[model samples]
Target: MMKKPNTAQTILSVASCKMTRAILRKTGRGGTAIPGIVAMKAAKNILAAVSEGMEIVVVTGTNGKTTSCNMIEHALTSGGHECLLNKSGANMLHGMAADLIAAADWLGKPQYPYAVLECDEAALKLVVPYIRPKVIVVTNLFSDQVDRYGGVQNVLQEIRTGVERSPESVLVLNADEPLSASLARSTPNKVVWYGLEASVGTQGNVDLADAGACPECGGEYAYDYHTYAHLGGFRCPRCGYRRKDPDVAVISVDKKGTDGSTIHLQCDGVIQKVRISLPAVYNIYNAAAAIAATKALGLPAQEAIDSLSSVQSSFGRLETFSLNGNRVQMILVKNPAGCNQAFSYVTGTGEDYSAVLCLNNRTGDGHDISWIESADYEKLCADPHLKKIYAAGDCREELYARLRKAGASEERMERVSDYHALVEQLKEEGHPVFLLPNYTSMMELRQAMTQATGNREFWE
Candidate 1:
């Protein structure tokens, strides 16, 4: 049982956070991290006080954190457990603290039995000490927010520090992700790994491989097969460190299309055919990570597997809406790895479609926009089904230039600076539409598109 905070400072912090959150919600500002910041200022230990007595599962990685966390939450709920989550994509310390504080009562007592938090990779170090989660899931490590994290290795170290802080927590990791798998060596936590055992398809060329070198030694790593980027069966010849056989492994992908995929998964020697409601190979990894985490929490594996079939796409990741009798899908892409996967999914559909590329160099998206160049835009250009290409957002010009360089026709390219005008134009087009946007741009464009298309707001 968790006790309420009676200290004067703690009591003051609780009041401040509750009052600020209420005011912000009423003002249409949206409940963000502001209240958490106020609470932390009033009482530095507010997070520790509010998050007590809950089984916490923190999901952190370069990509797939949000989707994976949502999957875990869905699985938990399907199994009849009440859980709280930070679904706003606010994974930093202040935002995390805010969500925890908001989920608690005035006395600073938790309102749920579990918390499935999607934490930022760098912010993990700050959050782990306070929450002391029962399970920590690292989806995968890719070169993301390079300007902020400095490099992929730095991001790995940050996550490693977080795992070290929660020594008693079980570490659930992606076995195919070499950098993520390496974290198990540095932490004494009981580690459970999940990855694909069978090949999904041919490994295509990518512009960058963040995990080319072994973390233990400078020797180049070898891969027996690669699903995408640096994730696969990798082994370092010098240090002899390699991917461990996953406790929960994806044995084969039976049928995969733009709608969803049917896969054969092996969890602890029990193989089951599962259907993941989401598309793309990356989502398969997300499903495996969620199942691994749920199993680690001592939940029924069958319930977790059953829940995957009904899981809807999160905020901006492959979320679809209907506009003017045409279907519009929004796929969030933050880095080259994610962008390439989105490209593959769109092209794989084999249906004629127009594309909208949105890029923003906002603070949340890491001011550096050079990483966009690393994405395989040529794949999109080569697709005969690709009809028209529209570029939007603050970095629209950059995206147009890249598309042209990849062989996009100048006559088919147009720039739409205004999101409203973009949405209106999209309505005029009679073909299926695919919208690709980076972090901040996704938020802005999603709001506009949802409003124009009569879709539910993210907060709803």
Candidate 2:
């Protein structure tokens, strides 16, 4: 039998939020179990008192939590305010607690002027009471982790409970996402909605992957233009329900190839332009959401914009690395809509590269890989530069079968059982590997790579 970790060592090690976050992510067992156990025990002896006049901001979404949290923290820190943050994609109850405990002084005092945390939707219900965030930012609600969350509605309700508990907190929502926009409907708090202008997208039949119905009326919502899957300008036909005119709106978006995007927005009556390093319309909204929430906390618009432009991809979300002399991208794909956005963004450019689609049956990535079938594999497989396909992980066979059903030829595919072996093979071939990994599989693969390369820098 394996021995449990030491209680004091675990708690003390978690003091550096960054180090604790990496330990939890690289500890294995689905990144949601052991660290959580340690955190639950750690929080018992580490209760903290909120400093006077300090603000607490909590950011949550199916995707973009890490990047959003990083941006928010960067803005606050750049503006000369001390910030306690979880920038390593640790968002569960234990991870959140570990971040807080790590941020605490030696005497267990929270010395920061503000705290910004990214929260896992399911974990929010359990941690919100302990953290009592004064500002809650809802990025977007998407179908992810069906096994743990049950479904999208359940995840929404879980986050809603957290938001309702801090009913006095400033609720900043994505006006583009129906579920996120509907969060403050019954709550008695300052609700501020944010979004992008309809003119930014092509004015036609907006291409949407899923969730086009109104959350309030279950009515078919009409879209002025869809910037990305299930996100854009939409209004309900039956109840006259529509996108709330945002207090902060992304008025324009200009793409700059791989460098990033420059977004012009009207935030709190101020017209400001923010440039972000990540591509895709989704990231624009992520930057916009961060700006809106931070603005409410009195952070300057220019500082927020500057911090956003300097941000990089958080781990597997789009973290690019040099592979075989070519820049390879890692865009996480789990559900239908997210897969579609990643697919659309990559394929929309008409550039092609080899791909490694790693899927797993781990708890954090959803034990059932049935959701992968809902993804648009046909479109993904047909891209011209897709030189090869590599599948590995707990559900490798299942993903292999799915790709075969999608008409992938045997000559174009390979399945390696070991992650380290796969990395070695990729390095030998010298071709860019566009890794499409599910949650835990991605972390496991990275852990293996980090160990093999002896480089903690890339893993960060």
Candidate 3:
């Protein structure tokens, strides 16, 4: 157990956070992580001190962490339960500490009993030891920011080290992903599994990641069916390792399209039809994870299932905006699997649309943009629904090179550095639009889109 701080220490810590946050707001820059750093410097273990008696649920993984966390938070709040979260999508230790600190009174007393934190996969070990959460959710894992973590194996190790620290915490693991599902053996922690039992009918890209190698034994395996990249029923040829029965599973994806999906789900033994407002089958994985996590937190499975229908898009993840009389949907693409899924959503229907693809190597966007080579833009190029494919950001040459290889003609693609010019063209064209940008590019472009479409809005 952590030693509680004295009254004097609490005052100093809270004061430090307040002063630092005020200065950041005044400067209009760097408000998320700095304040918590300063506060922790003043009083060590400030996250533990502020969250002394709170119930925390930490969601960590490469792709679905934010979406899964948002779904859990929505269910909690929609059911008349007040809770706090790191609204800025900051999953680092310092950002979460700042959020918890802000939620506390001057004496470092928590105002809410429930807190949901989105933690970075590598940082999960660091944050979980302090928060000692009631439940930890690991959405599917994949190679993310290879420049930072090196590979998926390294990230998997980081999460295991953290879970090892909290052996008593119940973990909600993705049953189909060997990288994530392998966590079940890392510790004595109780595990609740959730995943898609089969494909949602569109996971047919032959380029799916080679999840055939068993994480335990380095032997090749075979898949019964593929839902998406590296996810499905699997059994190792050498070792007996295989996918287990998921507690909360997507038994069948009843319907899916550009707008959204309707899936038949079996939640902790009860069968229910879940209509998720988000598009793509990846979100089906997210909804299942949310339901499992919420149930572990003592929420009724039905309430969590009911809340899935209303979970709105978080920040730049599949957010829709309106510009002059046109509707535009923005999807954040980080890796090959996620990028390919976005392509499927944009061209899933027969409706023609214009799109802008941005690539950047800014620190926030990962210094490596070579991942684009792994992403298939051929679908977008061949689709009859494509009007114009605009390439933006630092790596247009490389992006264009890949597009050319994918058969995109020079006449079919245009270059745009000025986001305002891109918006003006969209307004004139009056066709539906799709915005695909990485981390930094998304921030830069979403700023312009939000500024132009301030009043007119459409809910997806």
Query: Which structure among the candidates has the greatest TM-score?
Result: 1
Question: How big is the positional error of residue 397 in model 1, measured in Å on the Cα after superposition?
Answer: 1.0
Stretches of candidate 1 off by over 4 Å are: 1-5, 206-208
Candidate 1 clash pair list: none
Better-scoring candidate (lDDT), 2 or 3: 3
Question: Tens digits of per-residue lDDT for model 1 on 265-288?
Answer: 998778889999998899999999
lDDT of each: 0.87, 0.71, 0.82
Q: Candidate 1 or 2, higher TM-score?
A: 1
In model 1, which range of ten residues has the least summed lDDT? 1-10
lDDT of 1: 0.87
TM-score of each: 0.97, 0.86, 0.95
Model 1, 208: alpha-carbon shift in Å?
5.7
Residue 139 in candidate 3 has what lDDT?
A: 92
The runs of at least 3 residues in candidate 2 whose Cα sits more than 4 Å from the true structure, single-residue gaps closed, are 1-54, 199-216, 270-273, 428-431, 451-460
Q: Write the per-residue lDDT of candidate 2 for residues 1-460, one digit (tens) a residue.
A: 1122344644453454435455656763223334445544554433233222347888987877777787788888877888887765667766566556556654445678798888888777666665667888888888777777788778888888877777668888988887767786767878767788865443223445446467677888887767666777788879888888887788888663555788777875778667788887677777887778877676676677778877767777777766445666778777767776676666655455678888887766777778777777777777776778998888889999998887788999998788877777777655556778877787777766556554354324
Off by over 4 Å in 3: 207-212, 455-460
